[model samples]
Structure formats: structure tokens, C-alpha cells
Target: MGKGAVAAVFALLVVLVLAVVVVLITQGSVAIPLGEVVRVLTGRGAESEITRTIVLDARLPKVVAGLLAGAALAVGGTQMQTLFRNPLADPFVLGVSSGAVLGAAVVILGTGGVGWLAGLGVVSRLGVTGAAVAGAAAVLLIALGIARRVGDPVVVLVVGVMLGYLAGAIVDMLVYYTDPDRLQALATFTRGSVRNVTWDELQIISIACAVVLGLSVYLAQPLNALLLGERYASSLGVNVRRVHFLSLASVAVLSGITTAYCGAIGFVGLAAPHLARGLLRTADHRLILPASALIGAAIVLVAEYIAGGNGLTRTSLPLNSVTAFVGAPVILWVLLSGRSRKQAR
Candidate 1:
């Protein structure tokens, strides 16, 4: 697409993000009015203190969490697709998210004080987050190591799927022996939800996402070279090994932190980048990265609203339940349309 067209598309995405933010804020249980939402956000004072607290304390944090999780997953997915040269690669599909869940599960289930992390302060949160990142890194390194030796994208994809299943099995084993009372803490990790995120957690998520996302922009040019293959990328003066390591590390952090906070949010990473590429008709990471981020944020907000942000439903659905509707179709299209076959070749 031309620069003008791309600019217009981005503008529309920004507007969509803002519109969703307002809608989400307005649709919660208390149903705050748009004016009150705006007032609270702008520090203009709400019509009532209750309204202010609902917007600031409850709705706003959830909305922000959804935005951050979506963007981080999408950017990480975009890089994964490019790195693997596969149309279907993503954190969730490739087992990185499962690994994170395993890591968090170990902490939440193994510890006798299951509720301690929730009641404890930042230090506890960091500890769990660190464990989650370590798990994601483990899976990523194993997958990359195998991918290198095997040199077959299709084989690598299957290996990732198996790894995800393996991690999930281990988690199930832990759940089997653990006290049911303590299971509440681990419940959200199986299915995704942003409703539980707090301002303190948001502080950690925002800082990490901001730093990694900034680094993604710097990695874009080198990543583009990687799309041409490692040898070719090396010919263009790219440090292929360095780019591979940095990109993998970025993916691990983004997926791990998000999984730690939001549970296993399936398919946002997988779907968003494909949608961005289709919309812009380009594979360039420079454009795809930012575009995917916006599209991802919009997808999650819309999904959240459908999953019970509408306030009509008394019970909220697991985020994966809603996301699967979008992701499953994309997975089918990629497979049936021969995109995956082409990548395999």
C-alpha cells in the first residue's frame, strides 16, 4: 500500500481503539456513562465518587490490560512468523504460552501458600513473572535448537505442538494432586482473563512491554533481512545469530509476561499479524509490527466485550472461547488455502 493509504488505515485503527476503550468503560456492571468515563479519565471529576472509582479502579485497568496483552502478543507473533518463515507460527501455537503457564502453575500449585502471591506485594508478582519468563525461554530455546538441527519448518511446527501438549500434561498432573482450595489461583492460567489485573501488575506489564516493543522497532530492519534467509541476511551484513537470539528473547518475554497476567490468551498473536498483512498487503516488519499491534488491541477489546464486557451476561466467558471463533477460521484458511504447504516447501 502507498504511504497515504497506510497512514489512513493506521488512523482508522487508532480511532477504533479509542472507540472500544470508551465502549468497554461504559459497559461494565455499574454502566458508567460516557461523559463520566471521560471526566474520570481526564481528572475533571465524575458525577459521583462511585462512578470515578468504577472507571479508574475497575474498568480502566482491565481495558489497559487487554490493550497491552493484545499488542505484545501480536508483535511477538509477527516476529515469530518472520523468524520461522512460516505462516502459522505464534507464541500460543508454538508452546511458548504453554511453557509460561507451566512455570506459573509450578509456583501457584507447588507452594503451600497459593494465595500468598495475590495478597503479597510487587516482590511476589515479580517472582511469579520471572518464573513464567524462564519457562517460556526454556520452550523457546528448545524449539529453536531443534528447528536449527532439523532445518524443516513443518517438523519444527509439529515439535512445538507436542511441546505445548507436554507442558499442559505436566500442569494437569500438578492440578490432580494439588488441593482444590488452592486451585482458584491457577484457574485463570488455563483460560485467559484481563479482569483481575491491577494497577501494580499493569506497572510491570507496561514497562516490560514498552521496553521490548521499542526494541522491536530497532530489530525491524534486521528482521526484514532475515526474511530473505540467514545466509542471505548475513550477506546483507546482518548478524543472523544475534538477530535470532534477540527476536526469540523478545517473543519469550512478551508471551510469558502476558500469560502470567492474563492467563493463556490464545490466538491474538496468531491472528493479528495475518490480518495486518492482509489489510496492508505487505510483509515488511517496519509497517507490519505497528499495524499488528493496533489490530491486536482492537481484537482483544472486541473479544472482551463479547465475552461479557457487554454487562448483559452475569457470567463472563473464558477469553479463549471467544478468541477461538476468530482464530480457528484463520487456521483453517491457512491450511486449506495451501499457505502452510507453500511455507513448508
Candidate 2:
């Protein structure tokens, strides 16, 4: 794509994201006006106290959470696909999200394996974030170790899927033994929902996403070199091992923190990068990373609109259910395109 075309594409995505954010804030159950939503966001007040409460206090935080989670997942997915040289590779595919969820489950399900982690700060935002990052890093390290030992990318992919399954089984066991009261607290973490997050937690997610996302830009050139193969990347003076470590760490932080706050919202990480590549028709990370972030954020916001936790539907639905619709088709297309076979070659 030409510079102008790429710029135009990114510009459209930015405008689309802004428009969607406005729609999400305005179209909830009560259906506040766009003016009121903008007024409240701009430090003015809506005429009705209830309207103000819903827009500012109830929904704004969730929208922000969705935006952050989407961007983070999308960026992580782009990095993983490049790192593993597989279209099917994602944070979810590599079991990074599963690892983070397991860490949070450990805390939520308690050390005794039968109690809640909530006790006047036991389940604080920082605690869960820490546990999640730790878990994601651990799983990432394991996957990388296996990749190093196993020459075949497909073997590594299987190991990652098994890792996710193992982690899920452990989480299920924890849920089974834990008290019912504590289940609600753990529910959002696993099933995925942005509605319950508070502003304080949003701050944590935003800060982490910004810092880690910024660091990822530094990896763009190195990752592009890596696309030509490790030998070529090394010939071009790229440190393959260091790039792998840094990129994996970045993915861990982005995927882990989002999973911790929003639960294991699926498919954003899996689908967003492919969409970016399709739209831009290039694998260059410099262009792909930001484009992926915007698309990811937009996808999540659209999913939230469909899930209708606020007012669109009578009852809330899992964010995953909505995302799977977009995600599953992409998976099938990649498999049938013979992309997997190409990777094996």
C-alpha cells in the first residue's frame, strides 16, 4: 500500500473507534442523547441526575476497559503471529491467557483450594494483576522452551493447546471445590465481562497497556527482520533470542493484565491481527501494530454492544459468545487456506 493509502486506512479506523465509543456510551438501556454523553465527558452535566449516573458512573469505565482490552489483545496477537510465524498463533492460541487466568484463579479460589481470595484486600486490583502477569509469564516461558526443543512449529502449537487445557482443568477443579458465594467474584474473571470494573481498576489497566504497548514499538523492526527467518534476522544483526524474550514478555503483560481485568474474553487476540493484515495487505509491524490495536478495540466495543449488559438485551451475554462469531470463521479460513501446511513446510 502507498503511504497515503495506509494513512487513510488508519485514519478511518481511528474515526470508527471514536464513533463507536460515542455510540456505546449513548445507547444503553436508558438511551441517553449524544449531547448528554459528550457534555458529561467534557466536564458538563446532563439535565437528569439518573442519566448522568448511568453514563458517567456506570458505563464510561466499561467502555474504557473494552477499548484497552481490545487494543492490548490485538497488539499481542500481532506480535505472537510474527514470533511464531503462524497465522493461527495468538495469545489465546499459545495459552498465555489461560496461564493468566490460572494465576488469578489461584488467588480467587484461595490457597486452601476451597475459599475465596476476597477479604478486605485479598482480591484487590493489584493482587489479581500480579497473579495474572506471573501466570502469563510462566506459561510464555514454558511455550518458548518447548519451541526451542521442538523444531516443528506445529508441535509447539499442540503443546500450547495442551497447556491451555491443563490450565482450564485446574481452574475447573478450583471452581468445583470453592464456595458458591465466591463463584460470582470468579465468574467475571473467567467468562469475561467489562461491566464490573471500577475506575481504579481501569487506571491500572490503562497504565499497563500504555507502558507495554509503547515498548512494543521498539520491537517492530526486529520483528520484521525475524519474518525472513532467524538466520536472515541474525545476518541483519538482530538478536533473535533477545527479540523472542522481549516480545514474549510484552505479550505476557498485555494479555495477562487484560485477562485479569476483563476475564478471558476470547477471539480478539486471534482475529484482530488477521483483519489488520487483510485491510493493510502487509505484515510490517510498524503499520500492523497500531492498525491491529484500533481494530481490536473496535471489535470489543461492537461485541459489548451485542452482549447488551447495559440495555440492548434483557439479559447480559458472554463477551466470548459474541466474539466467537467473528473469530471462528477466521480460524476456519486460515486452516482451509493451507496456511497451516505452509508453516509446517
Candidate 3:
């Protein structure tokens, strides 16, 4: 697609996302009307304080978190895919999400406290996010190192899978000795949920998203050059080592933070870039990155709506389940088609 057309489509997607979020806010047991949703959003709703609270205070955070987390993961996935020159590279596949999950589980089960992060205060949330980021960084660093040594993408993917299994094993050991309540708190991390995020955490997410998204934009030129092959990029005067560091570090931070708060919502990082590339008819990072972010945001928001916003079913569906319904198909197609193996060749 032309740049103008791509921009228009992205704009339209954003509008659709906003509409879906509005509809979602008006859903659930209380069922605020569309007019009220608009009014509430506009800060002129005539509804009672309670209704306003439900819409603005309660639902708004979840929706916003879903938007940010989805975008972040998708963009991170795009970067990793490009970095490794592999279509199958994703947050989960790279072991970033698993690493984050392991870190959070260690904190939760070890501390034996209730709720996410196991009764961590704001400072502790930062600590947990840091731990998650460190874990992701560790995995990405190792993966990149292996990618350098290995000629085949399949080998790199297998290495990543082994890393994920190792992290899972550690999490299992932690769960074994932890009390049930703490284990319950850790369970949601594996399941994923935007609803559980706090406004404070939302603030953290927004800041991280803005900073990393901007950085990704700055690095897009270098990333596109990378796809031409490392030697070609080096010939173009791109600092290959620096680019790898910045890209992998940025991906680690984005994936870690999103997983830390939203749980390991899968496939988004893998799927969104493909969708964006398909839509834009190009794999150019400049367009693919932003488009993936917006599409990812839209996907997650819609998924949340389908999963019953705020106990619409008097119970919530885990975000991971809904996402898996969308993501698993993509993964299955990739695996069964043997395209991934072909690409590695």
C-alpha cells in the first residue's frame, strides 16, 4: 500500500478501536448506555457518581492498559522478528514472556502475599518490573548470542524454547513450596488480564510505551537496513552491534513490562506484525512497527470486550484464552505450512 493509504487505514483502525472501547465500557451488568459512555468520556455525563466511577475509574484503566500493553508487545515482537530475520519470533517464543512470568512467580510465591507482585508497594512494583526486564534481557541476550553463532533460525527458536522451559521449571519449583494464596496471585500472570492493572501501573506503562515507541522510530532506519543482511547494513555504516543492543534491550523492556502487568498475553507480538505487513504490503519497519502497534491495540481491546468486561458474565474470561483463540491458529498455520523452516534456509 501507498504511505497515504496505509496512514488512512491505521487512522480508521484507531477510530474502530475507540468505538469498540466505548461499547465495551457501556457493557457489563450495569450497562451504561452509548450516550452515557460518550458523556462520561467527554466529562459531561449526567449519570450518577457511581456510574461515572464504573466507567471512568474502573473500566477505563483496564481498557487503556489493554491498549498500551497490546501495542507494546506487538511492536516488541516486530523488532525481534526483524532482528532475528524470522517470522516465527515472538515475545513468548523468544522466552521474554516466560522469563517475566518466572520473575513474577518467584516474587509472588516466595513472598507468600496476596495480589499481583505479592503485596509489593509502588517501589516493589518497580522492583518487580525491573526483575522482569532483567529476566527478559537475559533471555534476549542469550538468544542474540546464539543467533550470532547459529546459521539457522530453527536452531535459535529451539534455543529460545529451551530457555522458556527452563524458566517454567523454575516457576514450578517456586509454586511447589509456596502457599496457596500466593500461588493464586501468581496464577493470573500466566492467564493474563488487563483488568487487574492499577492506575499507578498504567502510568508506568504509558511512560515506558512513549519512550520505547519513540526509540523504535529512531531505530527503524537501522532495522530496515538490517533486513538486507548484516554485512549490507554494516556497509551502509549502520553500527550493527549498537543496533542489536538497542533493539534487543528495547524489546526486552517492552515485553517485560507488558508481561509484568498484563500477564503473558501471547501471539500478539507474533501475529500483529504479520497482519500489519499484510495490510501495508511491506515489511518496512517504519510502517510495520506503528501499524502493528495500532492493530495490536485494536485486537486486545476487542478481545477484552468479547471476554466480558468487568464481570458481565458474573465471571471473567482470562485474556490469554481469548488471545490464544486468535494466536494459536496463526502459530499452527506457521508450523504446519513449513514456511518457518523454509525461511530459515
TM-score of each: 0.95, 0.94, 0.92
Position 298, candidate 1: lDDT = 92
Candidate 2: which pairs clash?
none
lDDT (tens digit, per residue) of candidate 2 on 254-306: 98899888998888988999999889999899999999999999999999989
Models ranked on TM-score: 1, 2, 3
Could you tell me which 10 consecutive residues in candidate 3 have the lowest summed lDDT?
111-120
List where candidate 2 sits over 4 angstroms from the true fold.
112-123, 339-345
lDDT at 93 for candidate 2? 76
Ranking by lDDT: 1, 2, 3
lDDT of 3 by residue, 254-283 (tens): 988998888888888988888888788897
| TM value for model 3 | 0.92
lDDT of 3 at 180: 71
After superposition, the stretches of candidate 1 with alpha carbons farther than 4 Å from their true spots are 112-119, 339-345
Quantify all predictions' global Cα lDDT against the true fold.
0.90, 0.87, 0.84
The local lDDT score (0 to 100) that residue 95 gets in candidate 1 is: 95
